[model samples]
Target: MDYNEDTATDAVLASFEETTDPRLRAFLRLLVPHLHDLVFEFRPTLAEWEYAIEFLTRIGQKCDDTRQEFVLLSDVLGVSMLTETINGQQEGTESTVLGPFHMVASPQRKNGESIDLLGGARPCVIDATVLSTDGKPLVDAEVDVWQCTEDGFYDVQQPGIQPPGNGRGLFRTGEGGRFWFRTVVPSHYPIPQDGPVGELLKATGRHPYRPAHVHFIAKAEGHRALTTHLFVAGSPYIDSDAVFAVRKSLLTDFTESRDEDLARQYGVTVPFVLATPRIVIEPEEGDGSG
Candidate 1:
């Protein structure tokens, strides 16, 4: 077979025609033509192709145990959100990107405990509940939460400054499917912009900021695990999120309260903020009965 632009795609796809996995074979068959079409249309010079390769190489090299450059790339390109939207749960809380900062494990803490290790910032209480779509409480549910510091950096992002688990906690829902935690209000922050993804954003005139939000991964024995964000209402970039992840349903108000009694209940001082969000979980497919 002659290897010309017109024949190249079919020839390459033919090589993968024998892929054992049905899904992989179908994906390759669908992907090759479009990829080849782009290559043919762009007609990059050898130097430009080399640069593209180098760019991807740097993206891989920038990844570490704490940072995921590929996910960051996918996020900035809106690919992550698109994929999530396509395969997300139909009922319950709306889903969003998990972001690149969830690389570390959350330390388990008791209900009503505080995840704010540094303290000294304006505190906020998160009173959350996990329930089934039918409003039944999901007992023993695990809710993993994490967020950036008041200064807009995760503990992993500022190693020496922020203590480990400074803004992270894993709590189990108690009676009535309730869990609460104390932490400082999170500030809007930029995604890591010191690597290849940053360079791409700069070149494209795109910002790297995400709005203030706390990430949650809620799971139970029979329910489908949910990964979502609770965006602070009125936060910067809510409308023009850098990663296009802001969903109106997930925007939650952080109300100010000077009630000393409520503050003491959550172990925070007065003049604090309160965020009360309810999470609904859907049962996994084939949840019961064989």
Candidate 2:
């Protein structure tokens, strides 16, 4: 039982063969070989291994109630987007990363209400509909939405300056599965670059900017929930999103509208951007709506 590069992985994997959970056993069986293969392929100096351990340690230390360094790590590495792609609904709006900012609960608000607490920024009205894949409107669907401010910082990112839920809302679809809300057009901003992930990005000469987008998590009683984004079309970094979460279908135009009547309807001043995004959910199994 001499430990060699090829046998090392097998020995470690065999140790997990007795795991009770089949999924866990399978994952370990697969992960161990690949990880060992990586180690075997690129043998590192003791100092390098120590530095790697310290890097991962710092990544864990950087996480908190409000910030998730692991999610950021997955995002910057494109793992989050890949996971979403693999598990996403087949016939709905394309899924994207549920960025770290969704750590808090969204405050419930009425339809057409404004999520923006600090006013005076340019307004954008989001008129959205939640429907089944068959085009049937889903009544009373919950839509949780959040975005950064016009200054490109989320409420959580600037706790002292931005009130809680400054750019977040939980609304339900009204009749015809419609929901609308008012908020400032979010600005393209860099991801938090104050931690290990930031250091990694800098070491790799990669930028940390993501395109302007609004996140949505739509759920209905009998339908599969959808977590996705409405990316601002033509926004900076749209084509080069640092997280690699952009899908062409999710890119939407926030058209400029100066209609006073439309402004009054949404309770916003004139010259606001109007966005209309439709979300489609699939019926869950055994829901009897299929």
Candidate 3:
């Protein structure tokens, strides 16, 4: 077979005939032709291809234990959210991208405890509940929560300033499948923009802002886990999340309240911000992951 434009794709596909793994062979079989067609259609110059290779190289080079530039690159390109959307559950809460910041394990804490290690002028309390699709409360459900600070910086983003496990907690749902926590109201802020992903965003004239929201991962026995967000109502970037993870059903209002009784019940001061969000998960079907 001649290695001309007419035969290049077939030649390359033939070379992978012994790939052993059927899935890999099938994947490459589909990928090679489309990639070759794209190259021929676009006709990128030598220098342009070199630049693209170099850009991907830098994205890999920028990754470390705490930072994930490749995930950020996928996220900015909408691939991450698209993947989550594909495997999304048919019932219960809609899944969203597990953003790069969820790289570490949350420290265990009691219900109604404050995740905010640092004190703030305004405190917000979140009362959360986990339930099955049939409306039964899931007691002892593992509810993991994490969020950025009031200024929109995560604990990992600020190592020296914020202590480890700041703004993160692992809680077990108590009676009525409820878990509560107090923290400072996080501000809507831009995603980290200091890597190859940032360069791509700038080149495309796209903003890197995400809406203010608290991340939640709910898990219980005999049910599929749910990964979603409690998006603050009327947040700055609610309609234009940089990562395209906003769901209207997930929008929760952080209502300001002055009820002394409720405040005393939750061990908080008067005139606090309160957000109540419920997470529902579908029961595990045949061969479903727990």
Candidate 4:
């Protein structure tokens, strides 16, 4: 068949007929039609297409060992959160985007250990409990935690200023499924915007700020792992997250406590912020709870 506008989608899809993977073949078939429709509906000249290709290339070029502009692209487009939501827990802590800054492995830490390598005004204690959907304590759960500092910059973002693993930690739930950490309350900050994604946001007049939150990934045997955030109550941009990852259930109160005894107990000083959040883990499929 001669390649023509009428037969373009069919021709392109047929070219993938020999694909060995059934799922991939099906996806290409679905993708081609939409692509063809886009082209037909709003036809672009060759120069326009070249600029589009270059735009995509720059998105890839912006990535590196510690930076991911493509993930940022998905985040700004709302695709990351949509995909996570599609595969997310239906009955427990709702999952959010694994923001690009989780670039490196968190340093392993013991319960009640501090993750704050830098000092800030709002010293905080994250006293958390991991439990099953049935309210049973989930012991030995691997809880990987990370967040920006009080200044709104991650360790990865500030190479020399912040030490490695400054605001990151890998902890395990211990007795009563408890895991605690000491850190400063994070500040709301803008997503990295010195790349092509930034250009797009500026052209669209959108701000790139996210609300103050601590990232957490909880994993326990025989249960589905959860990726979520503990959003500080009343944080700026809570209603307008740049990545659209916020959920009301994830809002946590960063209450202040002036009790010196509580401070000494958590190994911090008085007037520290306290956040107690319960993370309920959902069981894996066919784990008898499903």
State which candidate has the highest TM-score: 4
Shift in Å, residue 258, candidate 3: 0.9
Report how far off residue 94 is in candidate 1 (Å). Answer: 0.7
Model 1 lDDT per residue over 73-192, tens place = 999999999998987888889888999999999999999888989984698999999998779999999999999988999999989998898899999999999999889899999999
> What TM-score would each prediction reach against the true structure?
0.97, 0.97, 0.95, 0.98
* Candidates in descending TM-score order: 4, 2, 1, 3
Model 3 misplaced stretches (Cα beyond 4 Å): 287-290
Global lDDT scores for all candidate models: 0.91, 0.92, 0.91, 0.94
Return the candidate ranking by lDDT, descending. Answer: 4, 2, 1, 3
Task: Please identify model 4 stretches exceeding 4 Å from their true place.
Answer: none
Candidate number with the higher lDDT (3 or 4): 4
Best by lDDT: 4
- Overall local distance difference test of candidate 4: 0.94
**Clashes within 3 Å, all models in order:** 0, 0, 0, 0
Off by over 4 Å in 1: 288-290
| Deviation (Å) of 289 in candidate 4 | 0.9
